[model samples]
Target: MKDHPLEQVRGNPSRPLQTIRQLAIDPEMCMYALTMSTAESKNIKEAMADSAWIEAMQEELHQFDRLQ
Candidate 1:
């Protein structure tokens, strides 16, 4: 699997919940993003409307899609 960009913010205290939110909010997107299972995508987008990393997050997704 490809490394997740979220790893940049991983050490942050919110990493755990952020991970949960990502998987919970968008399982399919998460699967595609991290090249990982929905159970573990290292994290993806959230249900909320305002994510500062949303853009970077989307870019991280499918980046390896065609390659894979």
Candidate 2:
């Protein structure tokens, strides 16, 4: 059987144990979640074009209104 890419880094002293554990559990899902979590629009116009960003911004605004 072929080794997984992450498996090669299992013995690397510089790699954090927690990261290896998380990736070991599900590399593909972990990578997808990381990618989605880091994805951001570079400008307001781009952010406004995405419904997810719109919802997020609206929710943030609602929180500010509620706290004031």
Candidate 3:
């Protein structure tokens, strides 16, 4: 997996967390629930660390292609 362009080169761990917070504000993207599952879980941080962001972006791009 790779890192999403928006997630690329996150200066620090907080960066992704911030982005996640911001995205959550978008009503359209609200369905893409990204939050801590466990009591001490940190899904945003894990997303940044695991490079799931990139994979998600890639998936989104494919979805766009299919529509065309």
> Which predicted model would earn the best TM-score?
2
Stretches > 4 Å off in candidate 3: 1-34, 37-50
TM-score of each: 0.23, 0.53, 0.30
Among all windows of 10 consecutive residues in model 1, the one with the lowest summed lDDT is 36-45
lDDT of 2 at 31: 79
Tens-digit lDDT track for model 3 on 22-63? 767885444443323222325676665654565777899999
> For residues 1-68, what per-residue lDDT tens digits would candidate 1 score against the true structure?
12445533333434344455666688775565465322233345442332445655677776867578
TM-score quality measure for candidate 1: 0.23
lDDT of 2 by residue, 39-60 (tens): 8989998887777789998999
Give the total clashing residue pairs for model 3.
Answer: 1
The model with the greater TM-score, 1 or 2, is: 2
Best by lDDT: 2
As a TM-score, model 3 comes out at 0.30
Candidate 1 backbone collisions, by pair:
none
The TM-score of predicted model 2 comes to 0.53
Better of 2 and 3 by TM-score: 2
